[model samples]
Target: MSFKTILAVVTDQAHMSDTLAQAVTMADALDAHLSVVCIGVDRTQTGYYYAGMNAAVLQETMNHAREQAAELATAAKKQMEMSGLRWGVSEAVCQLADMSRYVAAHARFADLAILPRPYGDDRGIELEAATEGALFEGQSPVIVLPEGGAELKMPQKIAVGWNESAEALRAVRSALPFLIAAQSVHIVVIDPPKHGPNRSDPGGQLSQYLARHGVKVEIDVLSKTMPRVSDVMRRHVSDMNADLVVMGAYGHSRFREAILGGATRNMLETSEVPVFMAH
Candidate 1:
């Protein structure tokens, strides 16, 4: 019912600071152990690698990455030790293709996984692969942070992106702890699925369900004028000053390559706040 062991991915230099801030806060709040996984690897072994960089250049590039990883690991270790919370780090130097599997193998046992949003950019395919692998290859829910940054709080305001799919149901279940603790919970229905909220039967009894669990629930039906409703959801969350967005990740994947749904894809690309996702 509580997050007791939180696993955070700490690659992606752009996302490093944000990861530590949120991970440490979550760990401190829950009296949990924060395990940091910094995936540093030689992509040359896998035939394809970082865009435009050859093996010789990549070796130098990864040397810089490794140095930064070491600095981060040292800082995390010291901070956790001072905070009186248990922590560990894994700087797994391995093949690029195996990175996702490496992360999932370790992440499956944790209560929650924290990750950076996977970008299909020239240099970020591995991060996306790891995130995708975690979503489908593990049971735990993942909280993905946008590149800008985020801090974990007591989650005073929370928004649930509503849909009727099994993934949505799983996401609601996954977010129980946060919902049970929030000051206000919004069931945001945008372009609902077939069995979702409607004019007369708004929220399809989910509001009642959450209310039964002592959650302060409200249902809102938002009309979407854009193709990507995820953008709308993020806007709503920001408008509500919600700290967390709970939703299902709807997507198709092959060879660790994911073709996400519009809402899911947009959220990954442009979330201003932390997002809890399950699939």
Candidate 2:
């Protein structure tokens, strides 16, 4: 029901500071225990399979990977020490293929996972792997923070994007703690279906459910003027000044989203505010 244990995934040293600061802030706000995991992806796996690979070159490459991981672990320890929150630090040096598995193992024990935005300036294959691992493999709710997102205050106004899918329902349930604590919670349903229960009431059911959980709930049913669902959702977030967005991630198969471009992908690529997501 509450975030008592939080996991922060760090793949590189450059953005580690901002990532940890965001995690620490969330832990401090929720009085949660913070678990930091630094993942060092060994890029030498490709060369290791080469028939003519040199023994010394392989050893040097492996050593470099471990050293990078060690540096991140050291940095995490120092930051966590100064954070003054109940925390722990761990690190791993694994092949790129295994990065997500390592992250998922750590994520399984936490109530929620936080990761740097996997896109933009510092984007990497490792960051994308970490995000997928936490969301799908670990089966946990995740918060993806934008650049300098460490500066965010505890979310007050929240927006929930609803489409009546099972994924949407799960996301709403996972975000219950935040919704209960938020000053305002808007259940935004875009271009709702014309038939069935939604015909008479679109966000009505969800609003009542949240109200029962002590959420100050409202319904914002709007026509879809934009080409994509995410675009409509984004404008609504801006118009309402919502600090956070809670929504289901990858309602379709990952491949489908990649090829067809679903709302989850768009929101991840473009949202400036923090996105709280669950599969």
Candidate with top lDDT is 2
Question: Least accurate stretch of 10 residues (summed lDDT) in model 1?
Answer: 251-260
lDDT of all predictions: 0.77, 0.88
Which residues of candidate 1, in runs, are more than 4 Å off? 12-14, 45-72, 120-123, 193-199, 251-261
Candidate 1: lDDT of 69? 62
CA displacement after TM-score superposition, residue 207 of candidate 2 (Å) = 1.0
Residue 232 of model 2 has an lDDT of 97
What is the lDDT for 73 in model 2?
A: 96
C-alpha RMSD (angstroms) for model 2? 1.6
Root-mean-square deviation of candidate 1 = 3.8
Candidate 2 lDDT by residue in tens digits, 72-147: 9999999999988999998888888887788888888889999988867558878888999999889989999876
- Show where candidate 2 strays beyond 4 Å: 45-48
